[model samples]
Target: MMVDVLYLTAAVCFIFALGGLSRAESAQRGNLCGIFGMAIACVAAYLSVNSADFWFILIAIVMGGGIGVFIARAVSMTALPQMVAGFHSLVGLAAVLISFSACFAPELFRISTPSGIKVLSLLEMGLGSTIGSVTFIGSLIAFLKLQGIYKGHSIPLPLNAFFASSICCLLFYFTVTESEEAFLLLTMISLLFGATLIMPVGGADMPVVVSMLNSYSGWATSGIGFTIGNHLLIITGALVGSSGAILSYIMCRGMNRSLWSVIFAPEQAKANDAVASGGTRAFKSGAPEDAAFILKNANSVIVVPGYGMATSKAQYALKELGDMLKKDGISVKYAIHPVAGRMPGHMNVLLAEADVRYDDVFELEEINRDFSSCDVAYVVGANDVVNPAAKNDPSCSIYGMPILEAEKAKIILFLKRSMGTGYAGIDNELFYASNTMVLLGDAKKTTEDIIKAMRE
Candidate 1:
C-alpha cells in the first residue's frame, strides 16, 4: 500500500517539474523538483519487498550511476545534445536488456496468486524489450550524427530500405514463433535498424533528432513501467514521450522542414558562392583603430550569441567586452534566440553560468524591437540564428525559423572561425550585408583582440 503512495508522489513531482521547465525563470526549480521526485521514487522502490535477486539490483545501480556521473562530468556543453541522445539510448538499452533477462530467469517471474502479477510482468518485459532495443540503436546513431562522428549527409536509400525490410522480416519471425532465440534476434535486428534510420540525418537537424531520441527513451521506460506494474513510470514516461515528440515536430516546423525530409533529404550545398559574390553594402574591415573609433561614437550596442559562442567558450569574454563598452558610456545587452544552441535554452544556461546580468539577457521577441534602435550589433560565434534565410527564402531549409534581425542594426560585427555556413548548411545573408563586417578567426582570440583594441 505504501508502494502506491511512493509511486503517486513520484508522478506528482515529475508533473510539477515539467511545468516549471516551461519557462526560463522556472527551469531551475523544475529541475530540482524532478530530481527530488526521482529520489523519492527510488527509495519507495527499495522499501517494497521484492522476491527478485538482490545482486542484480545492486549491480544495475552501481553500473548506471557510474556511467551517469562520468557523462555529467566529462561531456562539454557544445556536445550536450549528443550526450543527451546517448543517454537516452542507454536507458532504452537497459529496458531491453532487463526485459530479455526476465524472460530467461523464470524464477524472477513468480507472482502471488490473486495479484496475477506474473502475467503483467511478462507482458511489460516483452514489450519494453522490443521497443527499448529499437530506440537504443536509433538514439545511438542520432548521437553520432549530432557529434559529427557520422557526417550529416543522407545515407543511400538502398541501405535504409534494406534495413527496413530486414526489421519487418524479423518482426514477422518473432510474431510467428515465441522462441527466446527468436526474440533476441529480433531485438538485435531492430537495434540495427534504429541505428541505420538515424545515420542519414544532417547536423542542422540535430536538435530535432535529440528530441526524437528523448521521446523514444520515454516510451521505452513506459513499457518497463507496465512490466513492473509501476504506474508512476508509465505516466511519467508517456508524458515525457508525448511532449518531446511534439517539441521535435514543432522544431522541425520552425525550420520550415518536415520531419521526414530532415531525416531523409540530402544535405544542401553550402552558401559559399552567394556569400562570397554578394556585394558588400556596409561594414568592411576598417582598422581595428577605426572600428574602435566607431564604437566610441555609438551610444548603444547589443550582442547576439549563438552555438559558436558556446563552442568557443566566449560568453565570459563577450561579457568583458560589454563591460569595456559600458565604461565608455555605451549601453550593452545580450540578446538570446530560442534554439540558439544545440540544446533547448542553451544560450540562457551558458550566459547564466557566465554570471551575465539577467537584466542584460533578452529573448527574441523582446530584443528584436531594439535592433533598430541599437547603433551596433556584435555577433560572436553565431551564424544560423541571425541568418536572413529564415526570413526570406522559402526554398531554404531554415526559412520559417525565427532569427535575430541583427541585420537591421546600423553596424554589425560578425565573428566566426571561418566563412563556413552554420548548422542549417546555408549562407548567412547577414554576412553579405553592407552593414556587416566579418571578423574571421577563433572567437576567443578575436574577442580578445577586440578588447585590447578598445582599451588602446
Candidate 2:
C-alpha cells in the first residue's frame, strides 16, 4: 500500500512536471518536479525489490547516474540531438534486456504457473522486446547520422514489408508457439527493420525522426512496465510516448510533411538528398559592413535562425546585435520556425542560452505577417524557412511548407556560408531576390563584424 501511495504521488508530480515544462517561465520548476517524482518512484521500486538484489541495484544506479551526469555536462548544445537519440537507444535496450530476463526467470517476476507462463505475461514480453528492438537500433542510427559518424545516404530499404511481416510474426509466434527461438528470431528481424528504415533518411528530417523514435522508446518502456507490474513506469511512459507523438505530428505539419510519409521514408522524400539548384543561379553578395549600415538605419529587424546558427555557435553574437539595436531605439525580434535547427525548440533554447528576452521571440504563426512591415529581415544561417519554392513549386518536395515571409521585408540580410540550400537540399529563391543581400562567412564572425562596424 505504501508503494502504491508513493506511485500515485509520483504520477501526480509527473503530470505537474509536464504542465510546467510546456511553458518557458516554469520550465525550471518542471525539471525539479520531474526529478523529485523520479526519486520517489525509485524509492518505491527499491522498497519492492528483494534484499539480495539491493547491492546489485545500488551499484547499477551509481554507475548509470555517473555516466549520465558526465555526458550531460560534457556534450555541447550543438550535439544535443545526437545525445538525446543516444539516450533513447539506452531506454529501448533496457526494455529489451528486461524482457529477456523475464523470459528466463518468470518465477522471479511472479508470472510462472502450473499451466506454464501466463498468456498476458508472454504477450507483454513479446511486444516489449519487439518494439524495444526496433527503437534501440533506430535510435542508434539517428544518433550516428546526427553525429556525422554514419553516411546513411544509400537508397532506403523496403520498410513496409519489414514492419508488417515482423509484427504479424511476433504476435502469432508468441501467442501460438510460445517458444524462445521464435522470440529471438522475430526480435532480430525488428532490429534489422529499424536499421534499414532510418538509415537512409536525409538530414532535413532528423527532428521528426528523433521525435518518432522517442515515441517508440516510450511505448516500449510502457510494455515492459506492465510485464514488471510497475505503475509509475506505466504512467511516465504513457506521458512521454503521447507527448512525443503529438510533437512529431506538429513538426511534420510545420514542415508540410505527412507523418506517414516521414515514417515510411517515401521515394519523394528521399529524392531531395541532392541539391535542387538549377545550375548556378545569380544572387547578390555583401560584406558585414553593408549589413551594419542597413541595421543602423532600420526601424524594425527580425532575426530568423536555422541549424547553421547552431553549428556556428552564433546565437551569442546575435543576441548582442539585438541588444545593440534595441539600445539605438530600433525594435528587434527573433523569428523561430517550428522545425528550425535539429530539434523542436532548438532555436528557442539557443536564444535563451544567449540571454535573449522571451518576449522578443515569436513562432512562425506569431510574426510571419509582420515581416512585411519590418525594415530588415536578418536571416542568420537560415535558408528553407524563407524560401519561396515551398509556395511556388508544386513539384518540389517541400512544397506547401509554411515559410516566415522574410522575402516580404523591405530588405533581407541573408547570413550564410554560401549560396547553398538548407537541410532540405532545395535552393532558396529568396536568396536571389532583389531585396536579399547574401553575406557569406561564419555567422558568429559576421555578426561581430557588424557590431564593430556599427561602432565605427
Give the local distance difference test score of model 2. Answer: 0.87
Worst 10 residues of 1 by lDDT: 108-117
Q: Candidate 2 on 60-124: residue-level lDDT in tens?
A: 99999999999999998888899999999999899989999988888878987887788888888
> Which tens-of-lDDT digit does each residue in 1-456 have in candidate 1?
988998899899999898997777998898899999998898787777564666787798899889889989988766778888888888888888777766676455342235333544545565677679878888887777777677744568778778677656665555444457766776777677676677766665677777887888889989877766678889998998998898788667556567777676644534433543355344365445555666778999988888888889988888888788888889999898766777666787788777788898998888898999999998988888888877898777676788888988999988888777676667677876777777877787778777788787
> Which number leads on lDDT?
2
Residue 41 alpha-carbon offset, candidate 1, angstroms: 2.3
Q: lDDT values of the candidates?
A: 0.76, 0.87
Backbone clashes for every candidate come to 4, 0
* TM-score per candidate: 0.86, 0.96
Give candidate 2 misplaced runs (Cα > 4 Å). 154-160, 266-275
